[model samples]
Target: MYDCIEAIKQRKLKKIEGETFLVSEKHILKARNGDEYVGLKLKDKTGIIDAKIWNNLLHLKDRFEAGDFVKIKGESNYYNDNWQVIIKDLERLDEKEVDKSAFLPSTKRDINKLQEELLGLIDSVKHTGLKKVLEEVFLKDDFLERFSKAPAAKTMHHAYVGGLIEHTVSVGKIASELAKDYDGVDRDLLVSCALLHDIGKVYELDATTFNYTTEGKLIGHIIIGYTIVQNVIERLNVLSQEKKLNLLHCILAHHGEYEYGSPKKPKTREAVLINMIDMMDSRMQPVLDAKIDDSTGWSEMIKIIGKSIYAPKKAPKELL
Candidate 1:
């Protein structure tokens, strides 16, 4: 067993020596006095910590990259309510020497249960062409395996292992229920889109580390997922041009705004529903996981959502 990041606290353990932390982020910053220092974000299975290298920086500066495992001589401290490490000496560790599992965070939910639910949704698509397209799409190559394990984003919501599959299945179930109440909505198409709206994330993110690749940064998961869907439609010849176009439109417009990277706005009922569900899933997740602050009765401000969420003092009387 390894020492967990959450266990090393400034108010508790106080100091540790010669600990290994994965280098998730690395950069150089110029100080006010014209001195340069290395800035880093170190991570482990529990969480991440801001770290700094202030001594003998030049000799070890080029030895490591963002993804490498580095052993460090450091002292941990709490500063402004956050933990950061001041590294005294460090050396890059080889991939084989480091235990990769220690650094990756995993979803707590059961993966098998999630996949079973997803397969059920895939079966629920009533459109013959769309069903066939989806079957051929998932069954081909090793796409299913990769999709089962990918994260929904590099950071922010659902960044841990198996997050993509969990989010997809959970949202698909919700969208399926929501579509049943609306007359014009196509539940089958909406469910299919819900299942696949973020499939591109499998290709967009680094499979093991959950970081964006160069292609992921440049092309983004939306276009990459769109391209994947377009290729499936071309080779399988399963759907009519209109169905294909609408499906592609849902994927492209799911982001809901031009500024947010959607190429077009949702035009069809199914597309709109898909957008709503995707947004609902991505936004709700972080808030649900946000920790409560006892003093202020609010969670720490979430930069992505731009506000701290308030934690209610007591459970509802209805629930009680």
Candidate 2:
């Protein structure tokens, strides 16, 4: 297969192996030579790269649009500290032939194991009514299936299949551990809030294309989650006025600030803790998903991250 960077250097070539990627952006222009060229921002799960088509041999502009996947034959080259590809050959690909996993970045963590651990934490909750309510929502056959497969966000942070669960579990674990250090924070409540804060994402995102739904775009996940939790609280016939209000507050304030999408700022200690943990988990995802190749070492200088990470160097045998 043509690795992305390798394609930019082999100009005047007929074909090269490389994965198909979505054209996130396209700019077609006329070069000084009077030949038509297309500038493209191509992206896959690993990351995005700049690509340019200078030859007039192909009608790529007519065939592909933004968000459509295209297999490209190109040579890799550097331009102003960035890697780019010079297109040599290209073809639009069928949906069935394209692996969705290859198109979306994912957490390096094992999803199934993380999910099971999260469920076990849910089971450990000592509060009878809270445990029952959580079980009712999480154990629903349809919701469980969809939640297990959904993406947490459209493009930010955890945006891949099973990403919702990974992020929730991470936040839940952090909140649970922090509860041990503080007396005001209820471990069960904090963990439950973290796990369910983004549960609405199952409805917020379209599973097939991994894009936001109309409701997701219009209402947002926080409101959707609050609605679901309120419905569950009403259906369960449990939870006192104080407990119910506190739970809702956590969901509403998990985004931390109004500007960040939280309708209400965190009020309760549990809500504050949940918000902090959620932010911590979300920020760590980009670093965890960064690509490192055998030759490239740690690819710390992600344009999105704005910093470079160095791989851990090997130690001398004497140290061992």
Best by lDDT: 1
Q: What is the lDDT of candidate 2?
A: 0.76
Q: How far is candidate 2 from the true structure (C-alpha RMSD, Å)?
A: 4.8
lDDT, candidate 1, 139-247, per-residue tens: 6898888887788876677877788998898889999999979998878788888877888898889966667888899999899989988998999888888888889
Candidate 2: pairs in clash: 2-17, 7-74, 7-75, 7-76, 8-75, 8-76, 9-75, 9-76, 10-75, 300-309
- Candidate 2 lDDT, 63-84, residue by residue in tens: 7766677888777665765667
Error of 1 at 112 (Å): 1.4
Question: Candidate 2: deviation at residue 107, Å?
Answer: 4.0
List TM-scores for all candidates, in order.
0.88, 0.78
After superposition, candidate 2 runs with Cα above 4 Å error: 1-18, 22-58, 65-67, 75-89, 101-106, 292-298, 302-306, 315-320
lDDT of 2 at 100: 68
